[model samples]
Target: MANPKRYTDDCALGPFSTKSQKTLSYIFSPTLWTPLLFLLMAAPPSPSSVSAELRTSGEEAVPTEVIGTLGGFMTLPLNISVGTEIEHVAWNGPQKTLALASPAGAVIILDKSYQSRLSISSQSYSLNISKLTPKDEGLYRAQINRKNSNITIEERFVLHIYEQLQKPRVTVKHTMSESTSCNLTLVCSVERAEKSVLYSWTWVDTHSFKSFESSTLTISWMPCDPDVAYTCTAKNPVSQSTSSPIHAQQFCADLRASRGRTVGETVVGTLGESVTLSLTVPVSRDIEKVVWMFNTSIISKDWREPAIAGPLMKSKEPGKDRVWVSDQDYTLKISQLKMEDTGPYNAYLCLNTPRLTSTQHFTLRVYRRLKKPEITWIPGPSDDSICRVTLMCSVEDSGDDVTYRWTFLQKGAVASQEGSLLNVSWRSSEYHPNFTCTAMNPISNSSWQFLSGNICPGPSRSMKHWIILFLITVVLLCFGFSGWCIWKQKRQCSAPAFNSSQVEAPADLSGQDASSSEERQFIHSVLLCTETPTGGTTTATE
Candidate 1:
């Protein structure tokens, strides 16, 4: 009886007073008990008591790929930290296991093929393979695990081992078309590399560049197209090599050749300009060296001629750094050409890679462009009876190859003359003439029409002089007419005006009869007064 409430709490499932459970039915309801039972059964244990979970998947992770050179050593990277506790690690090659290591035990390599070459680092646990070969290229797997755990992390790698790519060799095959054109098939390949190597080509010519991919490249051109140079590149995954630029020209030469050389070439040069020789001898060989000569004399920057021109062949032309020989071909270039540079030039080429010898010979002609011709005339004295004038047509720069032509126009007809001089003569009554001068050279020409005064005295000049006189006379006549008009105006202004209506008779005659003698006398006097020169109107008796 003394501890009834405490006893009832001990008997209840919850620590609540009877007043807290306002509805007794709800306090012991089955719906509340069902949910509480299900929640306890559905949930697992808390984090403090959980265990490590092991995961394994196949081909889920993307593999890392790397390049390796043949006969070179490469290590498979281990991404684990330096402080990572490594209980064990294993490496699997393309076909079998290669290496295995344990922190607590000695490293074991199961594969006999890689036993001598395989190695493992204890600190980083990275596996290194030495003396790599082509057969070693394939997928590799690394298995890594921590201490006291069955969990394993795998890393896959793809090894692409390749040999060192050396300088490639290019072989050329020639084909001819029905016309003058031809085709060249150039095959580029490396001898020391694997079959996985790729090839590409580069073709260079005047003002153009072209490229192609493949071990085989086909090139062709017309007779008018310029010679093109080509080079090839061979590359593998780990190494690259490029061939030397092809130096011979016979494969693309449009001109016929004899003994691998083209002869009888010509090149033109303008005065104060540069000139390059045209020598296209396509060949399938490597250029060793090129020697250029001018007029059977060797051409170099410092040229020396022999004292006595007997049997020894040497260059006599003064090079003075003016000549440049192409490294890729047998062509020669001369800068700032002079008039005396007009001569024959010979080029000798020596090539290897199947061994070849070629030559190129050409002539260079230097010319000065013609300047505009000018016509100047010397007029004779006006008092001379015979009209004679000298016309001279000349140019600033004259050359031996230059020529002159003259065209003369007289009256309504035209005439042509040669030479730079013209002696013109015409009488005073003859027609004046106009003329033109043209200067020409082998390369260019210039013409100038004479625009000066009449070359000789004739009716045209006389007519011009007469026109001047006529204009002067007309001006004088205009001045005389203007003066006469001014004089007439002044005479009118000085004279007096006259009116006849106001004339009257004298007062003495006013009383006289209309027929009186005095009236008649006054009338006569008034008329007489009016006749007076400088007087007011005369008064008369009315």
Candidate 2:
């Protein structure tokens, strides 16, 4: 076992009590003095003082201290002998040769070939162990056989060695998140690394971009356009690493639009017929989006993704000064027009200006056809008489303008003025004929009545006389009855014959009878004359 004392411990003097000192003195008094005398007798002549000498070994050597005494004065010798043997050994002149053994049992020969006079007795010694490596890790033993005394000592040395770690590596990759429009993340990591690592991140921060750093390297980013270089560097105490060039890219979605067009007014046809509606709109200039709508409902809006055969065709190009657009005007041909279709129609135009748009409206009208009139004869005394007969004419709804004409289809064959009724008097024409009245307008016309029905014959001479006689008799009877009634009323109220005494007329009974007979004879002759007819035909003009 090596010495248990630590290198940092302080060297202490030996513990000695008075009683133990006396015992040690008695033991060493005579018998031990002989060995001491021998040691002294064999000792070389001592010099005044010895200078310090450094030992030649490698850096593995340890510090050493030597002591020597001489000539009863205890002077350290300058010239001395040092070797593995601490017994009686002699030194020749000034030159010194020291022999020692390493802890690993190797013989080492140390020669002091050059020297002057060694003076200092106590030499503070250190070995040059820097050139000596760890494989010589053992005690090195050295002894000094000096002129005064002999001594030997050994030193133990321990060696340690170490090696540094290697540098780390960095790998970078780019990725994005759910929000595609957001900034991307550039993640850099130390791949297959053995040591603890650190990282830093930097990006091309233009007007809109930024950068950050993490342990190895992780990065969160935002949207910014950059035209400069973005670089990332990773470093350790051992080595530094940089990344390869990364190219950044971007993309966006295409813009979509709606077609701007409108349908206009319609033309109303008559009942049970169709009407044509013309839609008016300007053309499309560029590659336009077309959406077809009815009222507010969207019929079809995607012209690019047409459900049927493509609904949108190319419009005329806008060349030079002339402006060209798609044919947005459409004529809607409506079949089977109804009465309800006559009111109004609207066309909505969604045109594309720079920003603002426009719309339009229109109207339609329908009307009914006119109907002809009807005429009927009023039955009266003239129904069968040869005199004029009245006929009534009326028209159905003929709007504002209706023309009426009464035509005598008989021998007259003349058209009369327009009225509700027309009178025709029968005359002894060459032949009997038919009469008709026509009611006409621009749209339509119709005859009032045909004369195809039974005809009314003219009155005979006998019939005329009978009529006159009947009239005369009716007048006479009426007058007589009136006179009788007056006379009876007077008689009932007062005297029967007015008490004939009051009425004194010229006794004229026979005169009155004669006047009455004369008047009766005159009426009879007038009646007979009226009954006889003249030979020539006579037509009354009124």
* For model 1, the run of ten residues with the poorest summed lDDT: 1-10
TM agreement with the true structure for every prediction:
0.39, 0.23
Give residue 443's error in model 1 in angstroms.
Answer: 39
Error in Å for residue 176 of model 1? 3.6
Among all candidates shown, the one with the greatest TM-score: 1
User: RMSD for each model, in Å, please?
Assistant: 27.8, 37.9
Best candidate per lDDT, number? 1
The residue-by-residue lDDT of candidate 1 on 274-293, one tens digit each, is 88886675666565555454
What's each prediction's clash count?
14, 18
The alpha-carbon lDDT assigned to residue 406 of candidate 2 equals 73
Give the runs in model 1 whose Cα sits over 4 Å from its true position: 1-55, 178-180, 221-227, 252-542
Where does candidate 2 stray beyond 4 Å? 1-268, 279-328, 344-350, 354-374, 379-449, 452-542
Writing each residue's lDDT as its tens digit, candidate 2 over 211-326 gives 55663434443222222344555554334565644323221100001112223553435544555555455655331233222222222222243311111221133222111112
